[model samples]
Target: MDDNRTDKVLLYKGVKTMIFAVLTLFMGPIILSMALSQPENKLYIPLLVVGLLICAFAVFLIFKGIRLIMNSMFKK
Candidate 1:
């Protein structure tokens, strides 16, 4: 017989990561928009770069969260 059970800790971690990712995803666009709205501002370039990095990190976190969740559910 095989023992198959979900790893609660991993699932929780994954859920946490997903939540963070979602927040980052929303923030990225907002930051980018802010940066765009002030093209002449000294902070524009830095904000743009930070926004882009946040967006990329959000994507990475999403994938990582999914993988963690999948592993929690499927791995033995």
Candidate 2:
């Protein structure tokens, strides 16, 4: 196997993770806002919970992506 292949793979994985993280982070708030814009009170709690979960997962993704990127860069 070529030495650079692993580096490329890691880089690609990190980039994909970052992209997904950004989407998750932004979409969560946007969705929550849209949901709250409605006058109906029935779905508030559920939407809030789901939004928070999305945000939390986004954070985890962000951290994992950063870690993967750093590992790739420092790998010998």
Candidate 3:
């Protein structure tokens, strides 16, 4: 309804969208590398798990931001 909410929506969609998307995207490489490597490599399990978890969390954040933007758009 005002400039403050407009600014919030802009920041939400512009900054947060890119940040979360990039974080989630990078997780794929980490997960893939672990899967392709020897099973016994010490870091594989933890890295793979943590990477997937972070990816999931980032994706959730991205979705939440998208919902915020969408709701804001429809309200206008």
Candidate 4:
């Protein structure tokens, strides 16, 4: 990649990770609320599962971003 494209990608990646973190933080409480509101029929299970999946995906992306930054730093 060209130098400008590489720099842009790195900046965009940091922004993406921050956005992902914010989304996870915001969704977590809402999901937990939905899960807790209904108790008898085990309604929370599906919500919990989906929420965890999303959170895991976000975390994975964040880690990938960090690794990319580290690799670039070391390469430079």
Per-candidate TM-score against the hidden true structure: 0.95, 0.81, 0.59, 0.61
**Model 1 misplaced regions, further than 4 Å:** none
Clashes of each: 0, 0, 0, 0
| Tens digit per residue, CA lDDT, model 2, 1-76 | 6564447789889999999999999989976896778748888778878888898999999999998887787786
For residues 1-76, what per-residue lDDT tens digits would candidate 3 score against the true structure? 4453454656567567767678777876668677558678887777777767777877777777776676655554
Between 1 and 2, whose lDDT is larger? 1
Model 4 over residues 1-76: C-alpha lDDT tens digits?
Answer: 6452345567567667767777886787678677777866576788878777777777777777776666554446
When summed lDDT is taken over every stretch of 10 residues in candidate 1, the lowest stretch is 67-76
Clashing pairs in 1: none
Candidate 2 vs. true structure, TM-score:
0.81
Each model's lDDT: 0.97, 0.86, 0.69, 0.70
Better of 2 and 3 by lDDT: 2
Of candidates 4 and 1, the better by lDDT: 1
Q: Give the winner by lDDT.
A: 1
Q: What is the per-residue lDDT of model 1 for residues 37-61, given as tens digits with 9 covering 90 to 100?
A: 9999999999999999999999999
On a 0 to 100 scale, what is the lDDT of residue 67 in model 4? 69
Model 2, residue 25: distance off in Å is 1.3
